[model samples]
Every structure is written in C-alpha cells, then in structure tokens.
Target: MKRTSSLAIRTASAALTALLALSATACGGSGAPKSRSGGPVWAEGQGATEAVGFMRVQTPAGAAEMKGAVQHGFQDTTYLLSFAASTGDAEAFVADLRPEEALRANIPRDSTTYTTITPWSHLGLPEPETQQKVRTASVCPPCIKDERRSAVQSITIFVQDIGDGRARVYLKAF
Candidate 1:
C-alpha cells in the first residue's frame, strides 16, 4: 500500500509540473490573429531584415499573478526573457530580468534541432555582466520607484541568418 501511494504521489507531481509548464507558456499574453504562416506581425525595423525568427512576451502587472508571453513562429532558434522583481515594496515592481535565464530559456532542449541564443550585443550599450548589475539599475530601493518598479512586459526578437548574412525576424515574449 505504501508503494502504491508513492507511485500515485509521483504521478501527481509530474502532472502538476506539466500543467505549470503549459500555464507559463500561456502567461505572456494572448495569441495574435493567425496568418497563412500563423505568425505574429513582422513589418520592418532595426536589423529585422537580418533576422530569421523572433518571439514576443507581455507579462501581467500584479502580485504573484502569472503574466502573459507569446511565441510567434518556429524557426531554428528560440529565446526567453526572465522578469523578476528586484527592489522594495513599490520600487521593486518594474519588470526586471535575469539575462542568464533569458540565455538558457532561449532554446528548448528536448528538440533535435540546434537553437542559438545570443545577447543583443549590437544594442551599442554596455551590458551588465551580472544579473545583479542589470537588476540594480532600475530596481534600486528608491530611484524611479514607480517607473523603475519591475512590473514590466518585454518582447524579445530573434532572427535566423540566411545564406546572405541577412536574418529573418522571429518574435518571442515573456
């Protein structure tokens, strides 16, 4: 009877994990209207022409409530953005992120294809080496409390390079 109960508990835990994963994927936001390719809108901007794919995410604004994020199309690449609250009561609310999480979450591991997650090195600004550095700026205790508050929504853009060194833009969000 003990063994049977253990099996049931394990099964229940697995089910719960699967449910949470599914729920997280849906947390970013609602899906946009479908196109023939069934992807998000990609007009034109930045180095988008150099992109191969992308993802967009929009998180909810509140307490522990889950936020919304979305993935537009499937490409050889995947990306993820992690938003965390870094500061105090009011100030800690701006949507802050752990870039490392973004890097790891960018690609899905179970798939057979190769997916790459690169930092936006081209943004031309010095990036913080540690997640703390990134989190520190906007999440400081009292600075820009309202504006810096981590309650945020972000859109991460992915692009796959074609033969000509140009990429197709893919959108992902969190």
Candidate 2:
C-alpha cells in the first residue's frame, strides 16, 4: 500500500507539472506569427517604433499633382497624413528624398527634429515585401520638457504604389 501511494503521488505531481507548463504557454508564451522564411511578420498596425519629424522626400519636378489629408486616430493620439500621388512620380518622389532632410515642411516650428534617417526595418519591422513598391523612413524628435503632457515624438513614413497610376503616402506620427 505504501509503494502504491508513493507512485500515485508521483503520477499526480507529474500531471500537475505538465498542466502548468501548458497553461503558461497558452497564456503568454507564443508570440507573433512568423513568415515562411522564419522571420516575424509585420502585420497591419502592429509594428511601429517611435519617430518625431517626417522624412524629407522631395516631390519630382513636374510630376503628377498630389493631394494630402491629415487623419487623427479614434483610439489613440496618433496622427497620419495621407497623400495621393500620380503613379508615375511616386517612385521618383521617394527616391529623391534625402535620408536626413529637415522636416520643417511638416512639423511645427518649435518641435525638435532629428537629422538622422533610419529605415523602418531597422526598428524590428519587416520590410513591406508584399507591396508593389515601398519606401519607409523614421526620425525621433527631441523630448518635450513639460511634465503634464505626454508627447509622442516618433514619426514614420511609408510610400507605396497602389497601381493604376496611383500611389499612397502615409506619414504616421505618435
């Protein structure tokens, strides 16, 4: 009887250990989905790092006209500036942008702007390989001194071709 009780206790302990392990994995161990190449996939609105000033991409001279609008997020303090451009000029506009151009054209006069231009992929975001053509850049502005306000100083820009003589430009700032 003593040996049987000991074996039963051991079996129960083993089952409990297995249950705990499975529970932990089900709760938080699994992470974001991975691509076929074993790289993490950057899902829509999932991977964004902080940036401040907009990337400086020059519009090609005499390219098709462009229109823009600013959109505010409903659930967050994020802001996005969307631009629609002629497909012919979209690639050239993105290519002509200097990596470290000042963002005076988009940011407020008093806002601090960084001179460094970093690729979005460097911030743990996967390249937009699925898009027809895409370019992304980011800048982090200087931090605000006020204690009462929470300022998001990171900005990222994406320029992507959407086909049919149209390209979309997205500037996401948080």
List TM-score per model, in order: 0.19, 0.32
lDDT of 2 by residue, 1-174 (tens): 999999999999999998987877766666334334423322344321211122223445554323322223433345444455786665555444332443223321221332222223233332232343665665554342322223545555576666787766655555
lDDT of 2: 0.46
C-alpha lDDT values of all predictions = 0.32, 0.46
Q: Which stretches of candidate 1 lie over 4 Å from their true place?
A: 1-152
Number of the predicted model whose TM-score against the real structure is largest: 2
Which residue pairs collide, candidate 2? 50-154, 51-153, 51-154, 51-155, 52-139, 52-153, 52-154, 52-155
Off by over 4 Å in 2: 1-12, 15-77, 85-130, 143-150, 160-168
Pairing residues by index, what is the TM-score of model 2? 0.32
lDDT per residue (tens digit) for residues 52-93 in model 1:
122222332432211122233354222333222212311322
In model 1, which range of ten residues has the least summed lDDT? 130-139
